[model samples]
Target: MKPRALMFTLFGEYIQHYGNEVWIGSLIQMMSHFGISESSIRGAALRMVQQEFFEVRKIGNNSYYSLTPKGKRTMTDGFIRVYSLKNYKWDGYWRILTYSVPEEKRELRNQIRKELSLMGFGLISHGTWASPNPVEQQVMELIRDYHLDPYVILFTSSSIVSHSHEQLIKRGWDFAQIAKEYDRFIDTYQRIYEEFQRRAWNNELSDRECFIERTKLVHEYRSFFFMDPSFPHDLLPDNWSGTKARELFFNVHQLLAVPAIRYFETLFESAPDRELQLNREKAINPFIGMI
Candidate 1:
């Protein structure tokens, strides 16, 4: 889909926050602020309304709109999905990723270091740190989150061996309890992910009304693509490559972002009030260079 269409899906609900009666002129102003065209904004808004995300009222050559209950549910769900994955019960995972340095990319290194720290990673040395949990998804998300070029930096895990009891004590953690909780969380995550996959495989939502429903968070995807033009258009491991792999990869990856977005919806729902506000700002101003 076009960038503006995606943006509309992502932020259509937020328009209500500005005013109950969102006018064409107001939309024009908001779209212009993001380098979007009047036509694109109008089209996206109409699509959102059709999806039952918002109610558009026709008033003398102008249309004013506000979020429907579904829109509100979606926006809130989207927030929960994001924050839950990003911020779980994290305590240093008792593992470190280290790299030997030739001393050239100090600034670059520091940037990576700081970005990871914000994601709940902690530095153990000049070039070593442990993530708080065994969350590869969270680690990979951080790579995108920081907008870092992976080639410039190498990541390898440390081989420090310690008993769970010793490690947990040093980290001031309760290993058994956290491990049990992690197991439960993973099981739920897997089930939810499976459900999302099932829906994706079964649903073809490209009809006009479906388009409106599916495009709710397209704006964030558009922004992400713009931010990282080189993001590989690759598929999951199941779709290994030889010939048409690239095409399948691109299509699946593109479609897959929808569920990830939905997952983020739940994450945000579970976020602390302060963190939820921060995440909302992050969604709005993704271009602010890594926070």
Candidate 2:
């Protein structure tokens, strides 16, 4: 994962609820185990602050970071979706959005389309997008942000009787290819699960190794956020491999926790900031009940 994304996983998965604040020095220490350099972690931290992700403060000789309201909302959304067992219930309703922009505003329209795709909306037809996910507030925000309200229209419908949901999905998304990507993710990470389990039983995985493995665990799992829409259970194909892959992610992540904490503790073994890392480390894993 890139530093920005790794930092997001760190904040959302580890730092958000427990303390909701962290020192830059501690972040650099923790991230370095994942082969990130001091400069890179610090630079990412600065960028996050610049982007309003973190509210920054100085206390004497120390710098501390806390989530801005925007960051909190983003992290909360991530938590509720990424680690939750239940996908948002679809209620058999569809959110449909369409827009018509002048040629002079084609670039703005394209930008909206790109971002909407990333948000898991699928193109249902020319100049139209559809998603089962609730996005009314988000769409309104997007319209306001880009001054596109005059050019856009949106609606919701439950009795989509023109075609079966299956046909719409087939036309709107490449779930088959997405399935292949899920399998690749599983293939890449399954060995870590097996290895960690074997060594965990033997009490052999060192803190440093566990730290690297744990960060990579989330980093790799997070790759799906950009690609998979967490489509509701009703929409998934039969015996989807992604299901097993998601299960494996939680299993390995929990299995590695103790050792990862031990390694994280070492980051501030003698620093005055040891208590800061220790408190967050000792807090219950944010993902505990999420599965």
Candidate 3:
């Protein structure tokens, strides 16, 4: 994992629970298990600060980092999408968004496109995006955030006889490619899950090892947020592997949970921010009890 992405994973999975802040030394120590160097962590932290994802505070000579408000919002959004199963029945309407961002503001246009893509909006045509899911609120938030209300128009409507839902989906996304990626994830992680299950039962896995595996598992599975639109069951193909993959991911993740959290808390307890650690209740892991 890249240092920046790995740092986000750590914060979402562990640090946020403790107080949403961490000493640089503690952050480096946790990242060291992933083979990320201290220099890389520091550089990534600096970039995150510049990008407004993090804010830093100095305690004597030590530097502590915490998520900015934007960072918290990002992590919350990501956590919900990654950890929650999307099983809602889709309304038979499509949300269409069209934008006319000016040439001078091409950067903002690109950012809008990227965010839409991440939210599973597929490009139906130039400057037009559509999704079966109801994302009017998200789009509204985006428009408000970037002040693009003047250039963007959103609509909720059903297709006329000219095009079918399947046709529109085909125009928008490559389900075949998505299925193949799901297959790859299942194949790679199934073996790791099985092996770890055996070792866990035999008491051969260390807490540290469990922590590493769990972090790696979450990091890898989190990629699906960008790739999988997570269409409703009725929209997915009959042979979809995503469901099976999700089941396997949750099983492996649950198996590793206790030891992983144990290892993390050990490091967290030793952090220099003693008052925060002492007063804080046990961190509620969002992964636990999740389907």
Considering every candidate listed, which one attains the maximal TM-score?
A: 3
Q: Clashing pairs in model 3?
A: none
User: Candidate 3 lDDT, tens digit per residue, 94-198?
Assistant: 899999999999998887887788788899889899888877887787787678889999998976477888898898899899888889999998898889889
Candidate with more favorable, higher lDDT: 2 or 3: 3
Off by over 4 Å in 3: 269-291
**CA lDDT scores, all candidates in order:** 0.42, 0.74, 0.82
> How many backbone collisions does model 3 have?
0
User: Whole-model lDDT for model 3 versus the true structure?
Assistant: 0.82
The deviation in Å at residue 91 for candidate 1 is: 16
Candidate 1 deviant stretches above 4 angstroms: 1-16, 19-21, 82-86, 89-291
Q: How do all models score by TM-score? A: 0.30, 0.80, 0.89
Candidates sorted by lDDT, descending order? 3, 2, 1
Q: Look at candidate 2 and tell me the lDDT of residue 278.
A: 37
